[model samples]
Target: MIVIDEIYISDEVVEEQFVCDLNKCKGGCCVDGDAGAPLTNEELNEVINGYEKIKHLITAEGRKIVETEGFYHYDQEFGWVTPTISNGMCAYGIVDEKGIVKCAFEQQYYAGELKWKKPISCHLYPIKISKSKNTEQQYVNYEPRDPMCNPGCVNGQKLKVPVYVFLKEAIIRKYGEDFYEVLSQIADQYYASKEAKK
Candidate 1:
C-alpha cells in the first residue's frame, strides 16, 4: 500500500538516476506529464490567470501550441486526451546556464515565496487520483507507471507516506470528497493492520 508511487519511471528522470546518459531520454513527463486531470473551477481559473500573466513571455510558437494544446487536458474526436506539458521535450524547456533543458518548473519558475508562478499540479504528482472502470469507487494510486520505475529508493525515501501527506496536500484538496472517502477507507485498513501487527 505504501510503496506504490514509483509505478512509472519517467524516461528522463530514469536516465538521470541511472545510466548517466539521459540524452536519449528526453524529459517528457515533467514537461507534458499526465494527460490533464480534472480542474475544479477555482483551479481552472488559477491556471487561466497564470497563463495570462505569462502569455507575454510565451513565444509565438508557444502561444500557437497553447491554443492548440488547450489545457493539460482536452477534448478529442475519438474521446478525451488529458494535456501534458512535455511534447517530447516541451516547447518551454529552455536551456539553463549550465546548458541543459530544465526538466522541473520548480528549478525554473520558483522565485522565492512565489512558487505559484511556477507550478499548477505540484500537489498532483506521485499519486494518481482515478477510478477503475470496473468499479465506481474513486481511488488514488501511485502514478500509472512504466518499466523504468521500480524500488528506486532502496530504503524507500522518495515515496514515503510523509512525503505523500505533506507534499501532495494541494492535490488532495483539489481531488475533494470522492477521493477523500476512498482514502479514509484505506486509512482505516492501515490502522487495522497496525493494530493486528501489535
Candidate 2:
C-alpha cells in the first residue's frame, strides 16, 4: 500500500488495469448490485438539487419511484443509496436502445444540464473509498470483480491502463490534483522498485 497524507492506496490500484467495456457489461454495475450506488451527504444534496433537471431522463417507472420515495433510500448494508425499481435497477438509471443502462445524471451532465456528472462513488467504480475503522484515514482500493466487471478488467489489461490511471479524473475530483500528482510519482517509484527486485 502507498500512503499519501491521510489516504491509504492499495497496491493493486497501481498494479491492476481496468477500463469499463460497456458493450460487454451493458452497464451491469448500475443494475446488478444488491444496493444502489453509494452516496455521500454532499452527493445527496446534489441529487436533490439537480433532480428537476435530470428527472426527465429517467424511465417512467424509475421517475415514479423517485417521486414517491424521494431521491435516495436507506440500505442497512450500504447506508444511503439511490432508490431502485422493482427489478433492482437504480432510480437514476435509464436503458439505451442498445439495452445498456446509463446514469441520468451523467447524461444530463454531458448534455450541459447539470454541473456534476453523478455520485462520486459511481464515478469512481473499481476503486472504492472507505474510512478506516476508528481512524480518520481513507482507504482507496482497487475493486475489480468477476462476471460483471471482468470485461473491464480484461480490457484494461489489454490496454495497459492501470486502475489509478483509468480513474484519474474521478480521483482528482474526489481528492484534488496535487494528491493525484503525488500518487503518480509514488506509482512510478513503486513499479521501478518491483522491476529492480526482478
Candidate 3:
C-alpha cells in the first residue's frame, strides 16, 4: 500500500492493467451486483432531483419501481444504494438491443440533457474504496472481478493501460488533480525502480 496523507492506495492500481470491454462484459458491473450502484448523500439527492430527466431512458418497470419505492433504499452492507429492478438491474439502467446495460444518467449527460455525469462509484469501477477500520482514512484498492472483467484485463495488458491511467478522470474527480499528480509521480518512481532492477 502507498500511504499519502489519509489515503491508502493499493499497488495494483499502478501495476495491474484494466480497460472495460463493454462488448464482452455487457456492463456486468451495473447489473450483477447485490445492490444498485453505491451512492453518496449528494449523489442520492442528484438522482432524486433529476429523476424526471432520467425517467424516459430507463425501462418502464424500473421507472415504476423508482416512483413507488423511492430512488434509493437502505442496504445492510452498503448503507443507502440506488434501488434495483426485480432482476437486480439498476433502476437507472438502460439495456441496449445488444443486451449491454448502460447508465441512463450517462446517456443524458452525453446528450447534454444533464450535467452530473453519473455517480462517482460508477465512474470508479475496478477501483473500490473503503474506509480504514483503524483510522478515518480511505483505502483505494484495485478489485479485479474475474470473467466479468477478464476481457478488460486482457485488453488492458495489450494496450499497456494501468488502472490508474484508465481511471484518471474519476480519481481526479474524487481526490483532486493534485492528488492524482502525486500519485502519478509515485507510480512513475515505483515503475522506474523496478526497471532499474531489471
TM-score of each: 0.48, 0.95, 0.96
lDDT tens digits by residue: candidate 2, 25-89? 99998988869999998888999999999888888999898898788988887788999988989
Clashing pairs in 3: none
Q: lDDT for model 1, on a 0 to 1 scale? A: 0.41
Q: Point out where model 3 deviates above 4 Å.
A: none
Error of 2 at 9 (Å): 1.0
Model 3, 142-187: lDDT tens digits are: 9978778899999899998999999999999999999999999999
List the candidate 1 regions with Cα displacement exceeding 4 Å.
Answer: 1-28, 32-41, 56-60, 67-73, 76-86, 89-122, 131-137, 147-155, 158-163, 166-168, 175-198
User: How many clashes show up per model?
Assistant: 12, 0, 0
